[model samples]
Target: MPFMIGRAPVRRTLKYLESGKIVLKDQIKIFSINYNVGQGFKNKVHEGAQAFVFWTLPQLQYKNPDVQIVTFKNMTPSPFIRCYYEDGKQILIDIDSRSNDEIVNHLIKVIGKSKQVLKAEALAAEEKDNPANFGVGCARKCMCEIPGQIPCPGVCPLPKVMRGKYFYFKKDELENPEL
Candidate 1:
């Protein structure tokens, strides 16, 4: 007989953000989805996400198409979903779909992608609207420099990169977070 994992603790954080919210800042805006689901079950999906991080993360550096990366393997413990990535990135994502029927469509997977896409779109839009944001001749020069490890002059000493798995929801979708 196949054993079934009990879904009992899923109710603990009933009033958490599980979808989407965006906040804009002059230096940097954060588009995030917050999920504070079943906070603590360390299980198979969690293990899988870990494995993906270990095996895949090292190989992705300098990879184009997705300089910003996030990978999701599962959702466990009800409220919290499992995402795979390096440590230290601050993030929270929510897709806002009521039913999490399939693992592929889980909050982590969708919202993570949304964060990445929105970031790209924002940069593209900025570049498109303000040509002066670029160099004197529109030559490769831009008002701001790309973020990298070593800080460059006139650049943000620190840059905000999306990190961590967060729940997604529509505006006003989640109630005030239970303190």
Candidate 2:
């Protein structure tokens, strides 16, 4: 049976396979930036750090115009930046006690990464194997053969007539049937 996808908004992001292809697949649109830092202390080093981030913002924006920066202040005791890629992967770096140069270097390295890392490999198809053999043991049929029916424990399941019925036909009757 084919899987049916719902029409709800929450279920829209889910991927569905239909007719040997993917449907409603998720796509990476843009990269995002989120920064959450402490509120206290207005020292020169802090200002320089902020200036460094601001300076790097345009460089990232130039590379990806759709990139956005979100500020969340006083949320934590330390400072950290989170880079969320379109492939659902994220890179989080702690900069609570780092210098301006170190922070800039980290940001540059992250920005240099290609978007190819975000996408995962395609899913492969499953092989169909014969259920009876299934590479378990010998591939020969059962030796116990019954007339007008399959052998006991054959490669396939026996029908209802072979399972419960005791009516058996002779060799000549089986060769020339008039029913």
Best by TM-score: 2
lDDT of 2 by residue, 1-179 (tens): 13335433222223311111111113323433334433455342255345545544444444344555566554554566776667777767676566766776665455443334323222112233343432335353434433444455556777746653334755566566784
In order of appearance, the predictions have TM-scores of: 0.19, 0.36
Instruction: Provide the lowest-lDDT 10-residue window in model 1.
Output: 23-32
For residue 9, what is the lDDT in candidate 2?
28
1-179: candidate 1 lDDT, tens digit per residue: 12233442322222221222322211212222223222255343344334323332333222222344444334334223323334434444332323333322343344334566668877998667453344565644643453433444455443423212224543354454552
Cα lDDT of all candidates, in order? 0.36, 0.46
lDDT (Cα) of model 1:
0.36
Worst 10 residues of 2 by lDDT: 16-25
